[model samples]
Target: MVDRRVHEGEAVIERAVVDGRPVDADARLALDARYGHFTALQVRARRVRGLDLHVERLQSANRELFGAELPRPEVLGAIRAVLGDDLRDASVRVYVVAGDRPRVLATAAPPTEAPTGPWSVTPVVYQRYLAHVKQAYGFQQAHIGRQVARAGFDEALLTTEDGLISEGSITNLGAFDGERLLWPDAPMLHGITMRLMERMDVPQERRPLRAADLPRLGQVFLCNSWGLMPVGRVDDVPLRQDGKLMTRLHEHYDAVSWDPLD
Candidate 1:
């Protein structure tokens, strides 16, 4: 586990022993300093929106990955214990990972100041090796971020080898076809935002999407706990940059009720 400093903070490391000889001190310290060696989780709760969805998803993910059922109470207590009242009307993250003892970090920060105009994104094909859990065990997604950043885009929409759009690197991708939003027709990771919308009976089509279909799309947008974002372009394909659809969805999403477990 890792956390932002609530007060003064110091980086800690675990040393290795080999035949009674201390393993490379310099290398271990450097690794510990850079990573802070903690689990990672991203959460957002503006006006208390989608908080339960986040916690429940985390619980389910924990059970799926660790076989140890991490309770919502434990998760929330850690957040409140560290952040106190600072969590009000802000995005909060609680990161915990295994070390000598679990390291916990609870941070409250403003959400990403999203651009008012529609943004563009490229769809990249990649698979998450671990199907569940938000542990910082790998950097595949970080590599995806670098790839998208290098391509000069706001995000990357992940897809399967056969051309089914799965999700974004950090957000969930939603396709618009003049009237409805479409998710992947096949299996894909369930996103909190996407699940919330589905539960609210928001009209969404679960179907296969093809890259060649981009030219024919009326609009595109990305959704996540943070917000619904309109996509103005996809690679070289360009479209008008109004976020009307995204706005409509966000409005509906915000009106829904969700109380985080206290």
Candidate 2:
């Protein structure tokens, strides 16, 4: 289940500011040629949920990709500079583009709400390159996103060739076996929202969940920055949904304290 959300209106991205300054056309082209990593956050009322996690994500990704950590203050400053006090309730993304040096591009767009699913997904045999770090748009992820959209599915479920499940195209996958929650043990981004839910004291464990075992779960769900949603079906396999569990998860996630920006 790709975490890309449906905007309340057109998703218009504001001008991007790199390292606290708006870039020109040539600079924009320069950034396009470089390798980068990014993290998208939802800013609600000048605050963000999992703000520390978001920053740490950038810090760690910067270290892995650029050979040095982008300081936390600089990351915060870039966000503030780009947002320019105009974005209160909006979607803001901090991008770390690597050239001879690294640059942080902070940009904003319309805020998004989690898809209220009952979303259907089709499982495909695939794995992401450098899957741990949230690298910029990978070709395979985008390809599958388009394929599922054209194939009449809500999202694409990713599994290994041997049928061991890993994750969704963008969202983190979870399942309940009528008791404890199970997150796939395979390689995937340990998303911020997924980690927040883990702190809620839910009975959960990280383990290998197989795609062929879907029918045994009492509930199947997907989560990402937008929010959590129930899975209606995996391919042709109709899975059960627990409304009460979903309500509990959503409430806990929403109850997460927000970190103020500016």
lDDT of 1 at 232: 75
Candidate 1 residues lying further than 4 Å off, grouped into runs, are: 1-47, 100-104, 132-138, 200-202, 240-244, 258-262
* Poorest stretch of ten by lDDT in candidate 2: 1-10
CA lDDT of every candidate: 0.56, 0.80
Clashes of 2: 0
Candidate 1 residue lDDT tens string, 4-105: 121011213122222123336563333333222222223344234566666676666655545556666776665555334444444455544444433334
TM-score of decoy 2: 0.92
What is the lDDT, from 0 to 100, of the residue 157 in candidate 1?
Answer: 70
Error of 1 at 254 (Å): 2.5
- In model 1, what is the error at residue 26, expressed in angstroms? 15
